[model samples]
Target: MTMKGLYNSFMYAARAHAKWEIETSFNIIKNRKQLLILFIMALPLLIPAMAHAADFIGGKSAFGPSFFSPTTFYGSIAVGVVAGLITGCIGAGGGFVITPALMSLGVKGILAVGTDMFHIFAKAIMGTTLHKKMGNVHAGLAIAFLIGSGLGVTGGGMINRALFNYNPVMSDLLISSVYVILLGFLGFFALSEYIGMRKKSPKGGDAHGGPDEMTALGAKLQSINLAPMIKFDEHVVPGGRRISGIFVAICGSVTGFLASILGVGGGFVTFPMFVYGLGISTGTTVGTDILQIIFTAGYGSIAQYAIYGYVFYTLAMGMLLGSLFGIQVGAITTKVVPGTQIKAFYALAILAGFVNRLFALPEKLAQMNYITLVPSTAAIITKIGVWLFFGLVSIFAFWIIGTFIANIPKLRAESGYDVEDTKGGVSQ
Candidate 1:
């Protein structure tokens, strides 16, 4: 009798959790309406930034000439296109390119960071909520996490401002150094993952990092029970247990701080943290992540960067436009290519970014007089790294485009639908 009762109780809890998820989804849609207007209004202002030439007003906003030309406009498009292609093929690592790309174009480091964050915020505003996946979001978890993350975003923003205030060259050096460590780790892991997958047994388990899998950390976080326990995803936990708000906030703080400093949406990091660090189910984590990004990026970009005159609006918009279409095109090509090839490109692409950032660091340090080097030598080395970085990205993007074109017939036949390549409308 006791065993039977326990089974029934578990089933009931699972059902209740599912119902709660469904309710959450409805709320998300209802709230998104107001945000849509803001997205619309932001478009016109961004369009003008591409063509206007001005030095960053007051000189405090950034060191770069505020004036832009066709070079800045078209160049941003090209970078965006490549980034989008990468994103579409691999479903990740899109944010890694923007900061470096902008900086390499002679934009200041602070401006690049601020611009990238703005781009992310703009994109998030336009992102799809039409899928009705909102049910997977846990409001309680999101709210608690936001509390901690809010502080982190503020703290990180201040750190960047302080650094820029101290010395421009020092700021560049610091930002570049951060990128080197991050991209190096990201690229190495990507390479390792790709190589390991090739050697894996056909019947073996997934290559998810140990962090993606539950660990002692997740267990410890979940075990803590303070006042006002927040219950989320009863189905996953069997009994719909509660997590302390404080614990969730701490997790949020970690993600928010990194996102603010790096000028990214933080999805790449947050996904794993929620799943591994906080013991949240992957489904709920994804939904909650989307919710947090909209807030975090918006707050960080506007309050921290834009108000301080650190953002380049035109560049942000150009990247946004280019990446949007690039992602779509890349997504279409994935249907034609083998998955392994895509995986290889993912690793190689990041490594290319790694190389680009690493090579440029010496120049930044040289600028700060932290190292003995000729100015010309530093310039030459940086130029070479920039060339290599963009060269690799463009090659990959073109290869995908060419391959997709070559395989069009096969893809069309497979799908049993022909897309007309007209002069206007959907094709150009």
Candidate 2:
């Protein structure tokens, strides 16, 4: 063939090859979407099983304050680091883990909670700093929430002390009741918000009113002269700046009190309050919640050092290792999962936890007539039940993680393409 003809033939072959590659890419994309859906469907089953297997509770080494001893203090630091690492990785404050771990080590519930607070404070600060860098955290909102949260902690602490002195059992029950209530309300509220968002979407005119509703509520509040209205991107208010100050102080006091009393980081409540009541975005809410917890938890940890001094270094270190990787994995996963889905799942989880707390485990166990059953059979059944619950959870978690990992490349590609297409559309 002539040189020009030969070049033409080569071009034709290249075009055919390119078309084949495109077809293959399209097929891969289709398969990935299916995989993603399947993965999500499997998560609920997996998460519970993982929770059982993960040994989320029951550690004697985590029970008490050993901060008086350098060894214990150092050990607690290690534990805090591990727990903090997990919080960082999982997008949680790790108060759940730290408190339980401390309790297992013989730490009094009150002191363990205080120590956990200190740890949360430290980790939250770090997480907040990262979020701030990423521009996900709203400084104005965070400062506002901090004010309320700090006051809440202090108030909660005082209330706890008074109640404990008056009647420890009643105090415990009261706190538990509050937790149950908070959990229930939060779950319901979050679910409602999620539903409202869905309804407001273009698919439903009735549901499509979230922003309008938010605006209307904001306007009403602004008209009330609530004081200290710090305007961020969302709303402009007459006195929005002052709102977070007093409210945050109140929240802080209550949160502190709760931490001192029940040993929880209050993230669950705080997250909802910021989003619904505070009117901040979800990302900002999560970022701010983590930040505030760090400071509050830090103070609690220091107090532990001065008084009871119980910190388990070994356990903390181990936890830190596990949690650090988990956070990165979770953060990345968040990108793939729709925000609405994440919120709904979180709400459901909170609601479930609330329901679980309403019924006492020990009491239920006592009520069961296992004594009348065959000893060997009963023992086998119990062991199987425990293992099955956790083992399945682990498998499900692994499945979700694996699916997320598999789809990450696809998500990034799609996102990048969308951005380019949007830019191109705008330019034209």
Candidate 3:
């Protein structure tokens, strides 16, 4: 009789435990669902803030709305989705898209850049998580780059402030002009690179470098006995010793300074540096560069927020959500598409964006011409042309969205969509 009683007690305890477990799980799931809903609700507020600010909203509040329209949220959504799709295909941050989209809306350049940095931080983390799992991201390399870029950020910021404080108007104009020129130059190079690469046969052999070659350039630089040598395990250099301390510092400083001064993430410049200067394989360079950028930009975002208060949380949040989806899609597309063709395509897209920015030569001419009626007509024509171009872009934009939705099934069929199966898989 006593033993029977003990068995009943044991069963009762087991049942109680199972019930508790079920309730806990249900609560956790319920919380997650609520959070997701909140995040979704926040999207509208965030995307516009990132893309164009209130200026994009067609309201009169210091910033005037030219490109940003209250009527065009749907249009921005369409553009954002398409941009996400394209970035996913190319394996890159969609800033190239977001910046232009925001600029089109007449967002102040500084605010657009500050807000974009916030979005990039979130997107980079997402990409890093997935890539790390696939053995693509090098955490050690990331840390090393951070060490260098962290310092660069400070240096760049100081330089920027010094210039602005000394002469705000002249400094601003010079900086913007330089950015336009740089974009123009890079665009040309990208075009050339695209044309040359595209003409190559589709059946070309894989060009990923050998492990020994990964740090050959860095190793050679080590002979100089430069102070502050950082050791990191790079992708191609399998044995945990590649990239000298000095080289990392140099690279970091350059990237940070450029990013801070120009309000850019510096991936375009750093991407090539890793491949050509450091002699890292293309794939390793990209992964490592992103990891490094996350740290650099993460710091920059915080700093910019504190300094300028220029960030529109709404814009940052929206871009983050959009980018989260975009990066995943772009990373996935990298697997099925050939890298060569994608490279050609992305290069062309960047070039196009650069040209759009460079097209402001008339405004410069007007500024020189004393803003007279003759120049006023020129400015008006330019503005109209800008609108017309984006109008045409909207059509292609829809086509891109349709294409992405259409490919969902194919994306699912191909396992591990993050792989850079294509010739030019995404470049952040």
Clashing pairs in 1: 53-67, 54-66, 54-67, 55-66, 56-66
lDDT per residue (tens digit) for residues 118-174 in model 2: 433423432323433236556766676666655555565666555545654344445
Q: Candidate 1, which segments miss by more than 4 Å at Cα?
A: 1-67, 200-205, 209-214, 417-428
Q: Which candidate, 1 or 2, has the higher TM-score? A: 1
How much is 91 displaced in model 2, in angstroms?
A: 6.8
In the range 1-428, model 3's lDDT, one tens digit per residue, is: 13222222222222222222222223323566644754664655656553334333222232211233453344445445545655556544334545555555555444555566665564444333434423555565566677889888887766655554564433344445656665555446546655766786535543222233535454566455555544544433555444566676678788887776665566655654555466555555556654556666778766743245544445555555554454445545565566666666655555555555555445645655535546666667557645654654455344444555677788766644445555356633
- Candidate with top TM-score is 1
Question: What is candidate 2's CA lDDT for residue 50?
Answer: 43
Worst 10-residue lDDT window, candidate 1: 6-15
lDDT of 1 by residue, 378-410 (tens): 888998988998888778888888988898888
Backbone clashes for every candidate come to 5, 91, 31
| Residue 52 alpha-carbon offset, candidate 1, angstroms | 3.8
| Worst 10-residue lDDT window, candidate 3 | 13-22
TM-score of each: 0.81, 0.50, 0.67
For candidate 1, the per-residue lDDT at 137 reads: 79
